[model samples]
Target: MSTPAALRALLDGRWSDLRERTRRQLGVVELPPHGLDRERHREHVLRQLRVLASAGHPSTGFPVRFGGGGDLGGSVVSFEMLGFGDLSLMVKSGVQWGLFGGAVQALGTERHHERYLREIIELDLLGCFAMTESGHGSDVQHLRTTATYDAAAGEFVVHTPEPSARKDYIGNAARDGQVAVVFAQLVTDGGEHGVHALVVPIREPDGSPCAGVSIEDCGEKAGLNGVDNGRLSFDNVRVPREALLDRYGHVAEDGTYSSPVDGANKRFFTMLGTLVRGRISVAGGALSAAKKALTIAVRHGETRRQFTRPGGGEEVPILDYLVHQRRLLPALATTYALHFAQEELVSTLHEVLGGESDVDDRRQRELESRAAGLKAVATWHTTRTIQECREACGGAGYLAENQLPQLKADTDVFTTFEGDNTVLLQLVAKGLLTGYRDHVGDLDALGMARFVATQFVGVVIERTAARPLIERLVGAVSGDDLHDRGWQLKLFEDREEHVLDGLVRRLRAAGDGDAFEVFNDAQDHVLRAARVHVERIVLEAFVAAIDRCPDTEAAELLERVCDLHVLSAIEADAAWFLGHGRLTPARAKSVTGAVNRLCKLLRPHAATLVEAFAVPTEWITAPIAQR
Candidate 1:
């Protein structure tokens, strides 16, 4: 709810207004034209592409030199706001800006950037990120598409080569796209260079399929039907060898290939690391959608009368009921934490791109790890919150007119898209292992010796010891009457380390070629550890916000919100804490008690927090507006 002044200022600039006008234009000229029927929704998605092109969402992200506004931050901000009108429209806009234009800006060289970036940015050429294939949804390296170098003609021949190689579930593919940033294994006379992106023009200027490119529309989906998702297959599609976006690697004349990064595996991951940007944006997008649902649910609950109050003369607003408030308010607190985290993420992105700090190999991995962790946690949370928001609305929630079902359907794909949440969380766990490994080396002999002695001996020697002085410090500040933030944080940290150490030991024990097998087998436990780590991060963020609040009332409200977040997160993982001795029976009970108390305390601010998002009045006007 508390936005930095600079962020607020950016939100008020010309770009923001241009974005808002784009939304209004979309709402007026786009949605109505698309219609609601399944086929119509797909048509509408395709039609809205042209509409957005006219309104300039696609061109907003590119540099002015490339016929764009050249403001990435402003563009994403505007893209997020488009969700206020319609998510389908927002997604179509993303397929244009984030995928099509972004591919050129991030992966392509200056020549490629100049050649195609302008048309793509201008929406004169709609494009798709043709990366996900039928057989290799998450494992991009295993994708079957191939780009074989042809020395005679000096062009690379692209081919699906098989059914599994067909790029599946691509947006803007069925009806609108002329180009796609196709991900395929680039093979030359030298060797197979993992996956590389090639700009393939899949449609001609006359809106007809280009030579050797075939598309099949994926039929109606549960959500986002407004966006056409199609399967694409290419057969001996040829493009100049120069089409290879050679930022990381390149092919020389006479069929030679070279790269700055030596290791094949490292180069592969480095290329995919570009996708971390999308994952971070997805996390922010999830928060924006969750906040929207919470806004509607809270406002409706505040005004809609339910069972009788103590007086018994008339029914009460649903929000006054303890059950209703408890169900929705904690979700509101999470939305706040996610919002703050998103700001941090955007700042990191700008820092890396602006060269404020070196985004070297290690830093890139760290950024990817954090982005994945946040995306997994936030998307999973958003889906759950959407369900809770719908249930809180009771019958009206299911109605098509209210937009809850539509919102839920559209957002459902977020957990799996960008990257599968489970897969991503494991990446976070691997990052934690890497961090621990770094510490073990950094600590040297004496430090390592002390760590080993304390971990092993302290447990035995201090078995009967009472709570430490810090426990009292935690309880004093937390006021929860049982456990405290200090204990919860400590326990999460300890448990995370133990889990990672155990997994690593198992992995090492598995030995040779089965390393992947060992890693896959330990994935469940690793992901659980990652979840715990993310929860701790969110709790710390919540508490930090509360600690820094300058206003008395705001501070008190923030403290309650922090309590709500921590208690709810603990209750969600009660089994883990109980088994690991992090929480006693009484402390576990207090988690629920704290949840109830904080939920009640936060009920009044629920609507306020959502409104602070500043979504346009048209999308959500008041507590009672039906549309």
Candidate 2:
């Protein structure tokens, strides 16, 4: 593929420098050899975590004020790149920094961070995020762990009341971890408060198990075996009441509980919602895996010939086939989409942390909404594209040596972790609804400006007639004619609004009866809606990137990528077009034709598209590459 001079120039500057530095740091660490055996896989993961610690990759994100080598964005950036190395290592690093350390930073009071953040960051004290339990996975509120206040002893007695109450599938729990940031129900005289975090010391400094803390290894599982997954139970384990890590809720000396956030249930959701960072991290890792796989598969297809050229005399690369291009190129496009979205997400997160915006109720809600939407779409797309990339590589994809099989296995867990895809999609659904409610009433006066606004345009699209005419006019064009650039642009723009309207209408008619249930009931429709919304955002981002492109050729290639991506995604959902009367039969057929033609057009540059991501080679040492 050709380089867009603009993108290459940007990649050469600070971004390139950062990528090199990260690659150097990550290169010093190496994961253990792969094994087809599951138990051996688990062992390999543990070994890699130790390697990661020794390389000092986990401490890069902590605040320098707390003895960390503060570079929050760079830390996450580096960690995301670790997907190029191994998914297990990336997740292990996440558990160390994003979860254990993040829990302390986001939920714990200053004292907790001062006491444990440095140690955890430095990997001197390994930890687990003990939240998911046997009875709870995505529905964290249902978890049964308890931390009953023992006023007489001035402590909290942590106990797992039943076998099901045991924390199951906790990474780093059975071994390595000396402490855990445990999530459990906080019970005080203030009544049964919803789940809150408590910092618990699970082992002595010498690594001996502490009294009342029981650990049981999960043994073996699907993917990510390098890190130990274990079950943990506490039998009246006592900790000083201050161990509650009360950043949001605190218990007073007189047994009273106080919190700045109102309503216990809301507070619980608010607290759990902070894990959006983890969700975004999962998106990053999943994308890295998908992108690496596509890069390998594309490069392999170009060099590996199985058939004669079309004219029949000489051998030709497998990628010369239109079918191969269609299969692999869209996956490459999605890789770009996910990467761009993540960069936007990371920037937003930094702004939130830097106090660029007030962390008030409104701002928090906005952050939460954006996080849910981006995470839901990005993770779901990553899994779908990873599977596609695997198939694109054919039989070789199944081989562990190529890393696709292992990459897929490790990444498959991401959709369910952080929050199950279904649950997170519903959260995004509610956010869409909430945003709709806020904006719909004001659509009348701000009608013109609605199109210009980045968000809240859906309500305007639905509440007006002008959008219908626009759709009708755009729908008149045939998808087959490659010469109609103006018409294609108009069609793309109209289709975007219609898609947003279709979703807004569906959500509005559902009328607020359990956001998750509404989304679940209309699961297929809601997901389609979210995809359209996300794709539109991504395409717009890609187009905007053209201006930022330093070279005319790279900019042109990126524009084609944006076109191919938008068309393919739109064509995939052409059913929405037919159902809504937005497109006639001929035009609907044209959508498919347009997508196919675009795929062929962009096939030559698939490699360059993935490379444009500028991911570190150290992080993405997949087996497939140009030799």
Best by lDDT: 1
* lDDT of the candidates, in the order given: 0.71, 0.69
Residue 6 of model 1 has an lDDT of: 29
RMSD for each model, in Å, please? Answer: 6.3, 5.9
Q: Any runs in candidate 2 off by more than 4 Å, and if so which?
A: 1-16, 36-47, 205-208, 356-358, 436-525, 614-626
Taking all chains together, each candidate's TM-score versus the true structure is 0.86, 0.86
lDDT of 2 by residue, 224-314 (tens): 8777778889999999988887978998776788897787666776686556577777777777777777777887887778778557987
Could you tell me how far off, in angstroms, the CA of residue 480 lies in candidate 2 after the best superposition?
A: 11
Give lDDT tens digits, candidate 1, residues 1-627.
453332333333334465456556555443433237867776766676677677666665578887677656656666667766667777777877787677777777789887887777666677898999999998887899999999889999999988988999998898778789899999998889889999888988888889999989898888887787889999999999888888888988788988976777777877777656677777877777887788789878877986785668788889988899878988887777776555555555555553423356666666677778889999999999999999999888877667677789889999999889998887676566545332222432233333433443211111001234334534555534433657555655566566656655555555553434655676677787687677656655555444545556566655566667767877888887798777788878878887887777777777666666666666653334443
lDDT for position 261 in model 1: 68
Candidate 2 C-alpha error for residue 162, in Å: 2.6
